[model samples]
Target: MSRELRLAEVFVELADTLVDDFDVLDLLHTLCERSVELLRADAAGLILADQHDVLQVMASTTEEARVLELFAVQNEEGPCLDCYSTGEQMANINLDEVQQRWPRFHIATAEFGYRSTHALPLRLRGQVIGVLNLFCAEHAVLSDADVKLGQALCDIATVGLLHERVVRQGEVLAEQLQGALNSRVLLEQAKGIQSERAGIGVDEAFTLMRAYARRTNQPLRTVAEAVIDGSIAADELKRPR
Candidate 1:
């Protein structure tokens, strides 16, 4: 498909999250995957603030990106952190030049073979909830158009995350975000179990589980819980044909 058509499709997919079965984890993962494809980034990842205002890795396009995001959180430094704190976009940052600004983050970026990155805040109005991060393998800068597109994607995702239902019911945004973070932990455990049982990589295991959830018209978290409790066998998560 052409880039414009695919970009439109991505917007539709993100808008679909407004439904009752909306899965925050699935939505964030899809955002990361689409960001890489549409922005021509080597990898992408998302980090969201938990109830206590702590950043946690929510989704990533690759394992390396996931690990680097975690490193950023643990060390309390990185473009994502800076973007979140400032509620501004950090675009086309060369890792080699940012060593003095983010010493540890620079080192971790080098270790992951990422030469540049962009961090966009997942914000609406004045409230910032998280960050969407893009990593490039080459020391490159995003065009102004790409930066605007990335920020637009982030804005759509943030709106979906804080959907009107939460406000209509007077639900706390932090509590809802915390629920998604908790679901991520269960997903990790389930992925490991599926990997062992099916002799597959963790990434593949997650793919299978996600596919099974969609096939069954269930939430990803529900499928994950079933796998953890032995209610869903590893082999049952067949790849969608």
Candidate 2:
């Protein structure tokens, strides 16, 4: 498919999420998957700032610790953090030369054998909702066109992911009636439970839960309930192979 056609189809897929089967996790997964396909990247991941303004791994194509760790390193410093903070794109970064800037992220990506990365802030209009990180295998570099395409994908997808079908009543609490907000709350709780029980950080816990949800073809909240109820053992949801 032409890139334009593929991007149009991706928007359609995102619109399908607002129906009764709205699954935020799946929407994010689609964003990452389409990013890799359209941008010619090895893998992609999304980091969403939750209600608390803390960045969390919302979705990723791979669950490898090395790969997840690459995202985690951004919690302190990296292209993703900078892109998100500035609401700007950080494109075609040569990992070797960034040793002084993002030392840990640089060393970690090098150790994983990935040499370049591009990060785009998930901004729409004037609001930056999240960040998208694209990892290129080998000593790969993205063209100026590729960088623009990546940012376009991020901006377009942000609309669907945050479309806020919030229902309001003069007598009702807004958060109670907002499905998207409710989902975010459950996501945070699940992360905390998994982290506490499994002895891992919230980011790693989310990775494990997200990996398990994808592996079993289940909705994120269903899998989260299982984890909370002890139905899905944390050990069973181990990092993806």
Candidate 3:
């Protein structure tokens, strides 16, 4: 798929996961995975600042990315760190050319086998959370469109993460989301129970449960919880009169 299409699909997938309680790490992990295919980079990584302003590797496509990021941190240089510090992208950079920009980092990262690099800040409304790092074995300038696309993807992920952090609404929404996730676990258990009892497939049992929920105007999670808690009589599923 084109990067744009893949990005659209990514957002759709994320929207699907936004039910009640969502996992931030899961979404961030997805973002890093998609960036590799979307940008066609040899490797990619996500770096975020902790409470102490220390740059930590949140995710990476390869062991090399992890090592290079560590090299950057230790050397106190490299595109990702510069991008994060300036809140500006550092794109299509040849380590050999800008040897002065990050001398020690350039030497170390190139030694690790990456030739060209691009770093886009994960910025929201002027505040930078971290950077999205892309590295390629071939030394070439990243197309303007590709960099823009990278920034856009990072922006979408940043908003989604920050939304989760803020939407708790006195932490009620957070609790509700957690409850929904817990309810999903119950639904899984109920599906297994119904599958064994009715000699139906697990998927079929889920469909029946969803159909029941839709017909009764109750949420899927609520229906699942009811089934698991014995609040809904099992025999009730067979009666119409």
Candidate 4:
């Protein structure tokens, strides 16, 4: 299919989140995947705020991306953190030159071959709820088109998350945010189980879990739960299809 058609399909899926079975973290994961597919980015991730507005890595395209986002939260620096804090987009950042601005973030991102970064805030009701982070391996700045598309996707996701519950946005949003964070924790546990069973690294464990989830058309969290509870055997997952 053409890229445009694929993007249209993705937008349709994004719209579907509004009407039913809305899983916030899954939706955000889809956004991250589609962002990497459709944008100039090589990797994408999201960081969401909990009830206390503390940033946490909600979803990422890879284990490396997840680690980078988590490092941002742990060290209190990075484009995503800044974008969420300022409620503004930080685009076309040259990671090589930002060493002084974000010492640890720059060094870590450089190790991952990321030279450029963009962060778009996922804002709702005049409040920043999360951030869509995009990175490129090349030192290329994102075009205007890239920024517009990224911002549109971020806005759609934010609105879908807070839809029809604007009055009690605080409680509803907070609950959903907490749920996403909890899902991440469960994913970690599942990764550990998969790692033990497969004799692989945690990164490989997570990649395997995500692959199983996609292959089975199951929500990632559901697959993780099954893995954690032994309902789904890691040996079964390890065997080739």
**Model 1 Cα lDDT, one tens digit per residue, 1-241:** 8888998999999988887747888999999998898889999989999899889899988888989999999998888888999999999899766697899999889988889999999998999999998999998789999999998898898989887887897878888788899999999899899999999889899889988988898888899999999999887888454
Residues 1-241 of candidate 3 have per-residue lDDT tens digits of 6755867787686555454445444455467767777778888877777655667665566657767877777667888888999999988888776587888877777787888888899888897878888888888677888788778878887776556555555564334334434554576688777677777766567667766775786766677777777777666654453
Q: What TM-score against the true fold does each predicted structure earn?
A: 0.95, 0.70, 0.65, 0.88
Highest TM-score, which number? 1
Give the best candidate by lDDT.
1
lDDT of each: 0.89, 0.72, 0.71, 0.84
Model 4 C-alpha lDDT per residue in residues 116-211, reported as the tens digit of each score: 888899987678898988888998777898788888888888888878764354456688778878988999889888899888888788778877
lDDT of 1 at 78: 86
Question: Could you tell me the TM-score of candidate 2?
Answer: 0.70
| Candidate 1: RMSD to truth | 1.4
lDDT of 2 by residue, 153-194 (tens): 776677655555532223222232244445656776887888
Q: Candidate 3, after superposition: displacement of residue 106 in Å?
A: 1.1
Instruction: Report the lDDT of model 2 for residue 108.
Output: 73
TM-score of 3: 0.65
- The TM-score obtained by model 4 is 0.88
Ranking of all predicted structures according to TM-score, beginning with the best and ending with the worst: 1, 4, 2, 3
